[model samples]
Target: MVALYGALFLSAFLAATILPVSSEVVLAGLIVAGRGDPGLLLMVATVGNTLGSVVNWVLGRGIDSLRNRRWFPVTPDRYEQASRIFRRFGEWTLLFAWLPVVGDAFTIAAGAARVNLGVFVALVAIGKAARYAVIVAGGLWAMA
Candidate 1:
């Protein structure tokens, strides 16, 4: 059970970075296995996921001055778009951050765009927490 939680932590963290991975899928499996209480599992997964996102934000924050350097995968233009979306949507984007492919990119983009660290972390936490809650609820409902 703890291993599954740790996997979610590692997977979510790495996935938030440039690497391609799906912690959510693993979460689903763990839920099905009844490894942990659904609520607790969701909370752990969400926190792990959000922490991973912060890494990307920190990366972007570091690059605040130079924009996207040639070596980096992100570009200034993409960063601008992220900043605009974040400004318009504010914390809302975190809700959608759990989305399949887009979720990971959104996290990285948040950093590249240099969204506020505190707000960014909070939003990601909310978004991921919501996602896990929904998943657990649905899983329980289905089992019922």
Candidate 2:
């Protein structure tokens, strides 16, 4: 059970990062395997994913310092565009942080724009939790 939880957590975290991992597959596999309580799985996955987004948020906060560094891949125009989109959409875009490709960008943009940390976390948790809940429900249903 501990191993299963750890795997789920790791998968969730990686999925939330720039890496193209799919935590949903790990989650559904666990459900199919009947490894742990569904609620626990949901909680673990959500928290791990949310924390991963926070990493991007922190990176965004430091984007200015990192911009000129060769290690930083985002171009000036690209970063500016992301910041602009966040500015236009506002904090609500954090709810879509669970999405792929673009989701990580939104979280990073929120950080670069210096969004209220409290609101950023709240919205991100809500969105990520909701996504895990849906995945759990769908997995259980499909099993039945």
Candidate 3:
């Protein structure tokens, strides 16, 4: 049981990063397998995923200094485009941080834009929790 929860957490965490992990698949499988409490699984996944976004935020904070380096992952034009969109949409975009590739970019942009941490966490958590809740409900419904 503990191992299942841990794996879910790790999967959720990695899924939020640049890595190609898919936490949703792990979560759906666990729910279908009846391996853990659905609510607890949802909570674990949400927290893990939110913390993973935080990692991206932290990286964004330091990205400016390294942006000029040739080895930097994001090109200036791409970074600028993301920044422009973020600025246009404002911090409210953090609520969509659960989105796949785009979500990671949003978190990073929030950090670069110096969004308030409290706002970031609150919005991100709400979005992630809501997503997990839907997944949990769907999995339960399928079982029914």
Candidate 4:
């Protein structure tokens, strides 16, 4: 339903942020409950998750503004180190942006590293879409 997609979108968005939400749970619940078409659910989840990663990328771009804040989660040295790693490892690492824990960090680092925006969006979308595809396929397979 419309409300389900909205919840999935919000959950996916927050999951990609510093917050600890589980869009996956919402995704799986929808899948198992047979609420929406599988393809539609996959697309919605992918877009929502990708957009969340984009927020992290934008936040990465503003790291300097936040570095001095007492509430900043990352220390200055860690930021520098992550930047260095992203620089050395290359933007291909953006393919892992769908991962938990460090996935958001990768997006943030990509922003801090000033990765080409087109490349960032393309790679992030690919990774996130693939993840949703796998989840959808897995859930369907399990039910079958």
lDDT of 2 by residue, 1-144 (tens): 699899999999988875768999999888877889999999999999999888888988998786677645355666676667778889988898887656777888888888888898899999999998998999899889
Q: What lDDT score belongs to each candidate, Candidate 1 first?
A: 0.70, 0.85, 0.85, 0.82
Model 3, residue 74: distance off in Å is 5.6
Best by lDDT: 3
Error of 2 at 87 (Å): 1.2
Error of 4 at 104 (Å): 0.8
TM-score of 2: 0.89
Backbone Cα, N, C clashes tallied per candidate = 0, 0, 0, 0
lDDT of 4 by residue, 101-140 (tens): 5677788898888888889989998998898888888888
Candidate 4: which pairs clash? Answer: none
Candidate 3 worst ten-residue window by lDDT: 70-79
Better of 1 and 2 by lDDT: 2
lDDT of 2: 0.85
The alpha-carbon lDDT assigned to residue 98 of candidate 2 equals 85
TM-score, every prediction = 0.76, 0.89, 0.90, 0.89
Tens-digit lDDT track for model 3 on 86-139? 999999888888876568778888888888888888999999999989998888
Which residue pairs clash in candidate 1? none
Instruction: Point out where model 3 deviates above 4 Å.
Output: 67-78
